[model samples]
Target: METKVIINEERCKSCSLCVSVCPKNVLRISNRLNPKGYHPAELFNNDECISCGFCYLICPDAAIVEVRRPIKVKS
Candidate 1:
């Protein structure tokens, strides 16, 4: 499966809004801190993500760079 969300760690401000808004609960605050001394959000389970873009919309810092919907190929 392809990744649904792309997070820019440098731009993240350790906000939990994304985590709270994620319907699948795939996003989480990493234990590791970024260069700005903030715990950036990371994707824990890409397979579970529904590509709803909730995380992207809720992000105040615009850390989430991309939210992609899976391409369906007709057989």
Candidate 2:
């Protein structure tokens, strides 16, 4: 299964906490700003995410949630 991190822009504070803890460099600061007018965390390349949960674990804002892609099975 593939994994992806979904960021809640409303809750993020552009703290870059996730950017520091992410070993694979999955997260980055985007030019896009949230409603709060802060540039929050974003995915550089979501397909590379290993679901290490490092970002979620290190996030003080609880802004990131992980979603796993379902695998297909033969009938």
Candidate 3:
């Protein structure tokens, strides 16, 4: 089983709040800039996300949105 996370780059403020709040260190700020010219956050590995919701709740700008991906059943 694995988890996934998606980040909205334009909404991110690069405040590093998400980075610090992520106990799993799933979120990180990159040197890469968004179209809006602001540094943004990226997932270390989408599948590595634990869906802890720390990043989403801690974001001051409400930039981080967490989506959980449940493992599919193999019939």
Best by lDDT: 1
Tell me the deviation in Å of residue 42 in model 3.
0.5
**After superposition, candidate 3 runs with Cα above 4 Å error:** 1-3, 72-75
Tens digits of per-residue lDDT for model 2, 1-75: 343788888888999999999989888998988999989898777778877788889889888866454456899
lDDT of model 3, residue 74: 100
Pick by TM-score: which candidate is best?
Answer: 1
Clashing pairs in model 3, backbone N/Cα/C closer than 3 A: none
Worst lDDT 10-window in candidate 2:
63-72
Itemize residue pairs with steric clashes in candidate 1. none
Candidate 3 per-residue lDDT, tens place, 14-73, comes to: 889888988788778888999888899888766667788878788877667666767668
lDDT of 1 by residue, 1-75 (tens): 768899999999997999998888899999999999999999999999999999989898989999998898999
The lDDT-based order of candidates, best leading, equals: 1, 2, 3
The true-versus-predicted C-alpha distance at residue 21 of model 2, in Å, is 0.6
Give the lowest summed-lDDT range of ten residues in model 1.
1-10
Which lDDT values do the candidates have, in the order given? 0.93, 0.83, 0.78
| Model 2 backbone overlap count | 0
